[model samples]
Target chain A: MNDTVLVLSIASAIVAGTPILLAALGEIITERSGVMNLGVEGMMLVGGVVGFWAGVNTGSLTLALFLGGMAGVALALVHAVLAVSLRVDQTVSGLSLVIVGGGLSAFLGSSGDPSLLQSPNGLDVNPLFPQSLRDLPAVGPIVFGHDIVVYLAMLATVGAAYFLYRTPSGLSLRAVGEDPAAADAAGLNVVRIRYLATAVGGLGAGVGGAYLTLAVLGTWQNGVTAGLGWIAVALVILAGWRPGLALLGAYVFGGLRGLSFTLQLAEVDVPSDFLAMIPFVAAFIVVVAVSANPKRARRVAAPAALAQPYSREAR
Target chain B: MSRISVEPRAHGGAHVHLGVPVASLAVALLVGAVILAVAGNSAFEAYRTMFDASLNGWTAFSRTLTLATPLILTGLAAAVAFRMKIYNIGGEGQLYLGAIVSSWLALALPADLPKPLMLLVFLVGGALAGAFWASLAAIPRAYLNADEIITTLMLNFIALSLMNYLIFGSMTFWRDPSRQVPGGKKIPESAQLPALSGRLHAGIIIAIVCAVVLWWVLRQTSWGFQLRTIGDSPAAARYAGMSVSLKVLSVLAISGALAGLAGAIEVSGVTKGLEPRSLATDIGFTGIIVAVIARTNPLGVVPVAVFLAAIATSGTALQGIGIQVEVVFLLQGLIFLSVTAGEFFVTNRVSLSRPASTSASGTSTPGSDTAPVVS
Candidate 1:
């Protein structure tokens, strides 16, 4: 590939990976607090449409992003109420959120004016650096050409890694996830921590969805997030619940996706459908491979009480 | 202030209670109505229209049945695996694989063959294909201890892409070359399932028969007993000398076969060929809801599937009246969420009591002090 093509692909990959990275980071935090939220896809859809709707109506990008995150938080709150407060099965709760979110988004999106929903000029985030910096050599385009969200995603990854390992509150969060009873005994407020972590995760997922709508696609479509939310969920396992690794995994998957577009552009003879299957197939293979070895699986396994509800009275 | 607490019922709460399901449905409908009102629509009128369109006449009822036909099979598929505590979420994929295989058989078989023989071939071939696809996930889940939920969900995507590739890419084999739009060729008329009346095919009867057969097997057979035993407690089943891994594989295979049969029925009976869009509908996922609402009972699945199908049929009708069809999904989601929450109530009892010690601050979390005792 030519240098320009390579540079463009790398830049596109970074852009594509940003949303996934944000969502994964959110999920990692939620999982660290011992709550499994599988409704990321549903939340993302809600966020995507809500962000687009807000953006079109208000013409304020900041308000759209904020509302998009709130949309996600609203759905995640249902998950929290069911999984944490009511002690329902976490998987079922998450799945319900997916169903509700998907249906609601479709309903809302369809009811809106088609013209308003379509962005003739897609929403674009302001770039972090000047055009002059972006016009430099190969490194300039890869590093300085992207929007502010890209940099924010990178910063969030580093912040998450630091918070999880170095902070006292982070230690308490991990303790609650690993053993809620012990955490409760330690006066860490287990239920509160779980609720907060889950909500935070939802906020991240919502922002991720907004990023897709406002920065990536710049338009609203039903099920626009597609299976990217699910991919983010799997990315959590691939990253071994580490925020830093999640960034790497997201970029890799994003590159695979970007490669498909590049290959199509170059008129590669392979079927586009087969190329579309690469990321999903890769995720499946990785998950199966990791889970096949008992010792290795345990090494990077989910929290001990990941899906179990914590109730002091029950014990 | 009054405090509420829930305790698990004794003797496994085996007795059936009609009130629980009724209450759950009522709650869901009430919530849906509130949502409709908030959206600036008349909830009562919309629901009345929905019911009228789905059940007002024999033709509408038959349409509902036609939709329910595949759901019954897919519901059974989910019920079977769920009974064995295996989360087989790949019914959609398995259904696709079934359709693909059955369609291939319909094309490859000589047109001169007897109709009955061709029909049998389609059914068997489709079921086997579904079973084969299911086994792909079951092997890793049973032996490698891989999470079946993730594996099955992933397989659904791959299977969908493969189906699309076949119909959209391979022109000579699956695709109709003459057609501009991407779709597979129609199955031969001789191999098509016989129609009963007005878009209703013989597949409904097959679905009913399968449900009865599954109910009988689950209730009366040793295999069913072992399966339920494993589902309730795999560790205990293993202690009883049952091969847990083998049972898991067999259960998933059976589950996959049923989903596949649904696919074949859709092809030969409903669509008459594989169109990628028609084949990948939410029937498979909806089947999950059916199984859950039916409490995983094969016989129970019939009524639940029909109820959902009626809603789906009405959804299409609603679309004609300028209401988005997605409202049906919204209602379904509400029903699913409420039903799952209601399961907790069915197996447990709640009571209102006062706290022994009054706190001046009144800052304690609700339900934190209420103890639940396993009956």
Candidate 2:
């Protein structure tokens, strides 16, 4: 209830939501091109482990982030082969990818020195707003006092919104998801668009993984991502195939997540376990409920090829 | 006839139809080899050591069978649900429920009951319990048109926590009273499944029989016909007068039942009782890969289960050779990817021959289907 607590809560929410927002945006692009990369979690797992190990061993923060993104794209290429070229069931291929990712990440992190790499200090990354600006309003402190990734995450959302809704290629990508056969017939390079979009999606998801390790935990652990990948998947459902709306949903979920920690600190009566499960529970309830509403369903633009394998014979 | 008219022209671009799944396996194996070399062991010797530990002796072979039993059932669980175009991603959770129920039945029943009767009840009770648990997802899916993927997945975590809560928090049904280990009470000797060989148990035979029956049901029966129809095309199935809601529920229930049966057999046979930590074993998700590699065919589950079981048994064995168990874990993941991709070889091929197919590149959009003929 205090002003300080409220300010901190809002700040934490933005930070926590960064990963989900990044992943959702990437998934939006991939799905827009009629490819559902279920391996976001796997991509994240590989990214998290590889990035953490590489960064800590080399001690170059930038290299860590780069390796993390490449790790994601590397995993994405496997998905591209199965879901795109071979035209296997997108969902099956993706889920399988997650198993591979999770298992591999777990194996690599099971050993190795824990203290090899240090968490990057935010002092340099944080902005020094004039105390005068800090006094301006509640907005200044809550919005400006943060690390660099938080700002970039928001910028990426804006970029995704523009790319998905405003651009010509975006329209073509959406058209592919809506009807790949029709897109193909219309002279659209369906496979090319899907490949690039999926790879880009991987890049975004990888950044999310880096945010998790370098910003959130500052340490590597097996199964560190846990089920956050599923949360990202649920975010897509909640967003209803719209990238702009995903940002809002991620923030809301992130707020609930932050609130759970606050309640724990305050020693609130509610069990923290139940509270922590809120985002997933909320995602399930919101997506199913929204989809149930005829109005909401009509407004939401789910790609026709969300989970289906693309086959010329089927077409 | 003597001079073959002209050899049919193969598509120029059709050099390989095998996809990423296949490629990833090679990549994974290469990565594993690198890890092995890094670990100060010869990759070839380490693999040979793993095979020796897993498949060289009867003890290991029997252990593999014991492990394969549950995997086959879980794979069947995934395959059954998939045939109806449903994603029952919560097989892990469902298995937990079945294990809890079976353990409860083993403990509470009249201590004098015959073993065969007890086994039958245990199997049915566990399966029905799993079916009941799965119905939670199926009903929402049928009535609310909910995405089963999220619900089922969330339910798995819930199930895990619920089992932990019962044993670790409240209720004394299965919790061990004295032991410091995170475990549960042992099931009665009368309730336990009898082992058949060195380590193999009747669960293996039961799993095999179940696979055959499942294959028959899916391939030859009217229900199977209906299921395949719906899986291939929901719209067409609806027009054919099939009750979509009922079909979805039935398939998911059957799927849940098989998974539940797996839990029951494990509790009654090798595990001898359920434990708080038992749910963490990943027979469920691994089964999903098995089902996929087999292309959702029940009969194909046997080999897939055995191979995965061998890999699992050897995971610990790798530690004996100065390699981390994680290496085996990585290999399993890679194999899942490869097996999933290998399915293409058993089903379809790609050809880039006709201009019409290439026309897809020019259009920049998909061609609309005015009318699609039902195969």
Candidate 3:
């Protein structure tokens, strides 16, 4: 590829990766606390619609993103009530959340004037750095030239890695995931921690979804996030639950997404449908490879208590 | 402060098992009604219209049955695997592969073949395709301990892409080149399933047969007992010298085969061609709702699939009343939520207990436990 195509690919990769990065980072926190919420897709959809609607009406990006995240929190709360409070099957509960989120979002989105839901001007975030920094050769557009969300995603990744490894609360969260019974015996509130972690994870997913509408696609459509939520879920496992690796994995997958478009621009004959399969196929192959080796898989295995509902009396 | 404590019950009995799903359905409707009212729609009118469209007349009931044909098979797909604690969410993808493969067989087979034999060939071909698709995930999950949930779901997206590619992107055998717009080539008329009623076809018979046979296998056969044992307690199954890996592979294959049957039925009985756009309806996902509501019982899947199919059949009619058809999805989700919460009650009992300190501060010991004995 020429320099222009290369630059375009790199720029697109960062944009595409941001949403997965944010969502995966959130999931890392939830998974670390031993609760697996598979409702990320549903959460993101709700977030995307709410963000798009709020952005259209109020013209405030911050409100849109905040409300989007809160919508996710609402869905996540349902998951918490079922999986954590009611001690039901977490897998089924999470799936229910997706259905509810998808249905609720679609219902709310389709109502009222169709014109009202469609923002004439899609949400946009201007690049943060100055002209000179963005004008530098090769590295300029790739590194310094992105909206505030990109920088925030990178910052969040660092913050997540540090919080997960450095602080006492993070240690408590890991303890709850690894052995909730032991954590409960050690005076930790297992149920409360799980609820908090799940909510936070929802918050991350919501923001990631908002990013999809407000930045990348910049408009609302039914099922707009289009399974990216699931990809983020898989990325968490692929990253071995590390924030830094999640960032790396997200961009690589994002690069694949970007390449699909870039290759088309170069007039390559590959079908778009085939291009779409690359990331999911990659996700499957890597997941299988990681899982096939018991020793390697064990090192990055999911939390021991993941998806297990913890009850103090039962334990 | 009073505290509510929950403990597992030794046995739930027939009432709890049956009552929970029924009550959960009622609760889901109540919630759906409240949401409709909040959204400025008449809940009663919407329900009345839905009831009229799906169940009031023989013709409407036939349509419901037509929709339920695929739901039953897909529901069984999920039910079978879920019974073994295997979350095979790839029913949607498996269903697609079944359609792709079965439709191919239908198009390629000689038109002169006998009707029953032709039908059997394509139907089994579809099931085999689905089983093979499911095995992709099952092998990794069974042998490598990979997470089937992720693998299966990812395969779903890949499968969808492949189907789209066959009809829309490439000049493949599946595509009808004569059509200006992209579409699948229609199957031979001889391969088509005969209509039993309005839009209902012989596919319903196939679906019902599969469900009954699956019920018998799961309930009466030694293989079924072994599978159930593995599901309930894998450690015990292993201790009993059962081949856990082989069972995992076989069980998932069976699950996929059921979903595949649903896809094939949809092709031969309903759409009569590989209509990718129309087929994208969340039948596979809806089947998950059916399986869960049925509590993963193969027999239970039949009635549950019909009930949900009734709601789905009323979608376009509901839209005539200004309510979006997506409300069906909302109701489905609510039902699933309530059912899952209801499951908690089936296995556990919760009771509120007052603190001992309120009545007797000095006489009662502060740290004495008030835990109830379970079982």
Candidate 4:
């Protein structure tokens, strides 16, 4: 590939990867707190629709993204009520959230300006760096030729890693996930921490969803997030619950997505439809390889209390 | 101080089984009504139309059964796998493979083939294809301890892409080249399932039979006992010398076959061709909802599937009354949520008590398995 093509691919990869990155970062925290929220897709859908609605009405990108995150938080609160408060099965609860979110978003988005479904580009985020910075040498476009969401995603990754590994509350959160009974005994409020983590995770997912409509696709459409939310859930497992690895994994998957377009552009022998399967297939292979070995699987296994609802009385 | 204490119940009585599901349906409708009211639609008017459209007439009920046919099989698939704590969410993909294979067999087999034989071939072919698709994830899960949740989900996407390629992108065997717009070749007339009533086909009978057979196996056979044993406690099953890995492979295969059968039935019963747009809907996911409301019981799956399908069948009618069709999805979600919450009542007994002393906090004997401290 030519240098410009490679640079453009890299930039696009960052853009495609940003949403997944943000969602995964949120999930890492949520999962670290020993709660698995499978409603990321649903959360994202709600986020995207709300964000698009806010952007259309107010014309403020920041408000759109913020409302999107709050929408996700709203869904996550329902999840908390079911999975944490009522102590229902977390997986089932998460699935229901997806259904509710999808239905709610679809209903809400159905009545909006009919023309928005055509994927217009008016809502797109502008690049943070000036054209001069983007026009510099080979590294210029690759590094600085991106929108603000891309930069924020990178910042979020660093923030996630630091919060997870450095902060005292982070340690408490990890402790809760690893051993909720012990965490409870240690005076950590397991329920409260889980609720907070799940909400934070929802916030991230909501922003990721908003980012898709606001920056990536630049329009509101039903099921626009597609399976990116599920991909984020898988990326969390593939990254072994680490923030840095999630960034790497998301970009790699995004790069594969970018390569498909590049290959189609170059008129490769393969069908475009088949090329679209690359990221999913790659995910399957890598996840299988990681989980194939019992030792490795155990090494990178989910937090011990991952999906188990905590009750002091039960212990 | 007053405190609410929750304790796990040893067993749920018969009332819990029958009442919870019925209660959940009512709760879902109530919640759905509230949502409609908030959305500025007349909840009662919309529901009245929904009830009349779905359950008021035999013709209407038949249409609901047509939608319920695939749901029954997929619900059984999910119910079986979920009972063993295996999340085979790829029923969507498995169903697709079933349709692909069954349609292929219909086209390749002799046109002069006997009707019953053709039907059997289609059904069996579809089941095998679904099992094959499921085995892709099942093998890794059984041997490597890979997470089937992710693998199965990934496979769903891959299966979708494969379907798109066959119908839209390539002039493969499944596509009809003669058509201006790309689509699946129509199956021979003899291959179509015989209709029992208005739009309802023999698939309903097949679905009910499978459910009955599954119920019998799970409740009676030694293999079923082993499977249940493994589901409840792997360590106990291991001590009893049961091969958990083998059961995993078989259970998932069985699950896949059921889902695939749904696909085959859909092709033979409704679409009569590999129509991507119609097939790409959320039937598989809806099956999960069916299984959940039924509490993963095979027999319960049938009625639950019908109930949900009734709502779905009325969705178009809902749109006629200025209600979005997505409200059906919203109702389903609400049902799932209420049912999940209702499980706490089934499994746990909660009571309110006041402390003897005037201390701010009420206390119970921690980790005590004794009787409830009623007050």
The number of the candidate with the highest TM-score is 3
lDDT of 1 by residue, B163-267 (tens): 999987677587888888988888998878889999999999999999999999999998999999998899999999999999999999999999999999999
- lDDT against the true structure, per candidate, is 0.85, 0.77, 0.89, 0.88
Count of backbone clashes, every candidate in sequence? 0, 19, 0, 0
Candidate closer to the true structure by lDDT (higher is better), 3 or 4: 3
10 residues in a row with least lDDT, candidate 1 chain B = B366-375
Model 3 misplaced regions, further than 4 Å: A1-3, A115-117, B1-5, B351-375
DockQ of each: 0.63, 0.40, 0.71, 0.66
Better of 2 and 4 by TM-score: 4
RMSD to the hidden true structure, all candidates? 2.8, 5.8, 2.6, 2.4
Which candidate comes out best when scored by DockQ?
3
Q: lDDT by residue for model 1 over A1-315, one digit each (tens)?
A: 224667878888899988899889989999999999989998898888888888777877788879988999988888988888778778777877887788888777777456334555447567889988887898787899898889989999999999999999999999999999999888898878999999988888998888888778787777788688888998998888999989999998888877777786666778877887888889889888888878878788788889888877677
Model 1 has a DockQ score of: 0.63
Interface RMSD of 3: 1.7
- Cα deviation at A244, candidate 4, in Å, is 0.4
- Cα-based lDDT at residue A264, candidate 1: 64
**Order of models, best TM-score first:** 3, 4, 1, 2
- Provide the TM-score for each candidate, comma-separated: 0.94, 0.87, 0.96, 0.96
**Please, what are the lDDT tens digits per residue for candidate 3 over residues B1-375?**
456655678888889889989999999999999999998999999999999999998999999999999999999999999988999999999999999999999989897889889899989999999999999999999999889999999999999999999999898999999999999999988789999987899988888998999999999988899988998899999999999999999999999998898899899988888989978788888899999999988889999999999999999999899998878878888888889889988888667755555573233242244343221
